[model samples]
Target chain A: TQLLEQSPQFLSIQEGENLTVYCNSSSVFSSLQWYRQEPGEGPVLLVTVVTGGEVKKLKRLTFQFGDARKDSSLHITAAQPGDTGLYLCAGVSLGNQGGKLIFGQGTELSVKP
Target chain B: IAGITQAPTSQILAAGRRMTLRCTQDMRHNAMYWYRQDLGLGLRLIHYSNTAGTTGKGEVPDGYSVSRANTDDFPLTLASAVPSQTSVYFCASKASAGYSYNEQFFGPGTRLTVL
Candidate 1:
């Protein structure tokens, strides 16, 4: 089983602050995805990075895959109340069972205005 | 679009009782998944179905069972509920086109409490 560990289990910051959440694992993965979930709702996918050293940007959010494909990071610029939620990272490998995802512990972020 | 719907949005059951969580998707996704989310454990996969008539065990499948009779529905059953099984359960499905890369659409989730 692959284990992904996320740092800063709980984070609280004022609006407009910048924050970065990290997801690290010892096992190599073919793809990594980031998801944000609000209270009482299922998680929504934010981004998926398939290649090492790949970076994708959506609005003010930037997602980076580690050079070794064993880690990933999510950076939020000028955080807003809307960005507050539980952020999770999931890793997927290649094979017939490739679609299955291994998730991290998740980081809860609180952005207060 | 009613991408996915789960019955009994929330349920409370006594220990040793039987319960089945229903999951249905309208997109006709070929693959469906069941997962449980705990306070500190993020989301753990319980069971998954690649297509109709086929199923596979996930990371935490000891206490859960699933069946897929068709492409649109996948239900999870707990034979004997325990307090340790209490958690928010989520149902998800992905289309065959993006099975390798795209994200899976998720249901609203079912909150289950076992006493």
Candidate 2:
């Protein structure tokens, strides 16, 4: 079974602080996606990285996919209170059909102003 | 478009009772999925249907069942609820027109508590 392990399960930071969340796995994936979920809401797609060493940016967020396709990372620059939420990384395995995803245990971020 | 909607925003049930969570999508997505979210577990897929009339079991399918009678709805049923089954349930759908990066649109989620 493939599993994605995420680091720093919980983070509490002051406004304008930079933080990075990591997701690692031994199995390779075809693509990786980042999602942000607020309380009582389902996760919303942030970005999708399909190539090895790919980097995608969305405003204050930067997402990187590992060259081996076995890991990924999300970095938040100058995080504010609005950035506080649960971040999740999910991957689509090679040759998998129907867009099935293997999700990592989320990283809960709390940004205080 | 209404996207996806789930019924019974929150529910509380006895341990031995049966429960069904309803999900409907107006986007006409070809693939629909059911996932359960718990603390420290993120979201684990319980079941999925690639299209109407076909369904597949997911990682944590031991205690849940799902059915897709049409293109718009996928409902999940728990035959006998257990305490460990208490979790928030989310329904998601994805279109299969081209090479998909697995961009699934999700519902607001249903909070279920088994007492």
Specify the highest-lDDT model's number.
Answer: 2
In the range A15-40, model 2's lDDT, one tens digit per residue, is 99999999999999999999999998
Candidate 1 deviant stretches above 4 angstroms: A94-96
Off by over 4 Å in 2: B97-100
Candidate 1 residue A11 Cα shift, in angstroms, is: 0.4
Task: Give RMSD to native, each candidate.
Answer: 1.3, 1.2
- Which pairs clash (backbone N, Cα, C closer than 3 Å) in model 2? none
How do the residues A1-113 of candidate 1 rate in per-residue lDDT, one tens digit apiece? 67999998999999999999999999888899999999999999999999999999999999999999999999999999999999999988656254788889999999999
Question: TM-score for all predictions?
Answer: 0.97, 0.97
Cα lDDT, model 1, residue A63? 97
Residue B55 accuracy (lDDT) in model 2: 94
Which predicted model would earn the best DockQ? 2
